[model samples]
Target: MENVLSSLIPPHGGKLVYRVLQSAPGKSHLDSLAKIRLDQNKQMDLEQIAVGTYSPIEGFMGEEDFRSVINTMRLADGTVWPLPIVLDVSVETADQLAIGEVVGLSDEQDEVMALLHLEEKFCFDKEETVIKLYGTDSLDHPGVRMIYEMQPVLLGGQVDLIRGRKSETRAYELTPKQLRRLFDDRGWSSVLGFHTRNIPHKGHEFIQLKALEDENCDGLLVQPVVGKKKSGDFKPEYIIKSYEKMIENFYPREMVVLAAFSTFSRYAGPREALFTALCRKNFGCSHFIVGRDHTGVGNYYDPYASHRIFDQFPDLGLKIVKFDEIFYSKKLNQYVQGNSLFPEDENDTLRMISGTQARAMLLRGESPPVWFMRPEISSVVLDSVRSGIQVFEG
Candidate 1:
């Protein structure tokens, strides 16, 4: 039974989608793409689809899929895809392109990214997308703001990655196939995946360790998002270095694997949490740890919304390990879940530190106490801050 459950979950549509051009196109084909350019977000989306990171999605969503996903959180074919990955282009660009035509995707520097085979061009209801996906249409939400800023036109079709380039985080990035092979090679049948965008604190470690033990899993995967994030989030380099130090000196190395996930953060709170879990499921994780305010931003979402959202998707194909908020208990001299503590006098100690406080402390040249964070990890952050490194620069 364990072996059966350990078998990798299939890519959403029962096969891994790789739409990249296997061989170089002719000069004529190349010339066609030179006429149009794609932005960084679309480039990233194409790369993701080509590599099967966003498997089951062969290309950008068509009008049918887009409308269905916005109204029902499923594709037109009834596939349970929560997020719509459509390529938005300006009206002028759309005017120059037509169905059955192909366009070249490029970056700001004129570096070719992909060739989009246009299948459909349509307009989306931005207001509806914001309401359905984010539960609010207010521009105050980053995801909503992004939609409002995008061009009114949407391009739908398959993409042939023509000029894929290795990313700086490539050293830490692992495809689904590679990760599955790693898990098999390590004799790990049940792996718990933990996703994070910020530096890991003691609470984070406590939850990960506890989940590993409670689930009696074979290993833990510390997969951090290393793509475009809000300005105040931890830098990819700092996040990677800190985790390396923490895993080497603190964690049981044999039971843990660290990798980077390159994907943009939508900050859609609960919906984003579900989307992330599906990605991890495709990456061969048998279980995922969902903590308090998982994938949330500011106070837009309920504290336990991420946990509750799991109830709505009973067939997500991945086990969700729900964890309560963890805080330091001075009486116990260790981290404990919020519900485990007994009532005590005002003098009794139970304190929790926010990520904001941790960052502020690091920026102030102060290290979080050993109880709240490992010295090695905090030291790396301190060093980066002292060097005047802009850890959150996009």
Candidate 2:
């Protein structure tokens, strides 16, 4: 039998999707089709889909795929897709659109971004969608709130990006195909992917180090999600800069690389965790580290829910390295697992900071305790904030 968790990873759908249009459409072409303006988050989804970031899922999901994903965590074809990746449209827009018609997908500014080959349009049970996707329908949940605010109709189709974002040359802003090529060029067969949305704290460094060392991995990718994040989370630019500093000063030069994952956070807890890891697999990461509340928010998920969900997919085609929630133990003079020598009652000996707290500290021009955040990493955040840069999402 073959090693199902082999490091030689393949794209989720076996073949990577590349639907980028090589050139801009002609005037008549743009004028010929109906246009739908995509919000920023949806625009990011379009680009990712166009580049195989969500491989095997070439476009916004049809009703069949959406229902299958929401109810079973699988695509209609039984592919293990943890989240429903669908395009929502206003009921009026859906009414105007007809089946089999091609539509132009544009930004709010009306710049033509892509062409959606519309295959299906359907209404869904909003309450069921929220409950299934989030495990909650309470508006208190951020993901649930976003879902509740969405339009009632969904459009499903394949897309062709109009060669935009190609101007972006940063190595960190890479697509799945480009990322896989980078891993191959580095000769990394068993590279580990570490996901983050915050500036690198000592806890994060500790987790990555433990994962790298424990796994005996050939390489490590410090991939940070640089898309729309919660309000208090660090901005993408600073997150990238902090890691740039972390890798420069602390990590081995050749064994690590930093890349920005251009996908937004859904705060779907365990489901998003599984979704992110599979995305890493498409990016050629053979293994992924799931730590703490893995993509969770506001006490909505069990801390180790991400760890347990991996068991459901025996042939996940990737390996998940689960780590206990870690904190800086002053007694040990460094970061350690929660189940370490220090007991829970020893509050004075443990140091931990939430992202909201960290942001507030930066706003106050104060460096977090050196135990929780490195001076260098903290300096990057402080600089970004002090310079009037929008360092946090609002």
Top model number, TM-score: 1
| Cα lDDT over the full model 2 | 0.83
Q: Residue 11 in model 2: shift from native, Å? A: 1.5
Misplaced by over 4 Å in model 2 are 1-7, 165-171, 340-348, 353-356, 384-390
lDDT of 1 by residue, 121-172 (tens): 9998888788888888888888889888988999898888876655788888
Clashes of 2: 0
Q: Which stretches of candidate 1 lie over 4 Å from their true place?
A: 1-6, 344-347
C-alpha lDDT of all candidate models, in order: 0.81, 0.83
Which candidate tops lDDT? 2
Tens-place lDDT digits, model 2, residues 248-285: 89899789988888878787899999999989988888
Worst 10 residues of 1 by lDDT: 1-10
RMSD of 2: 3.2
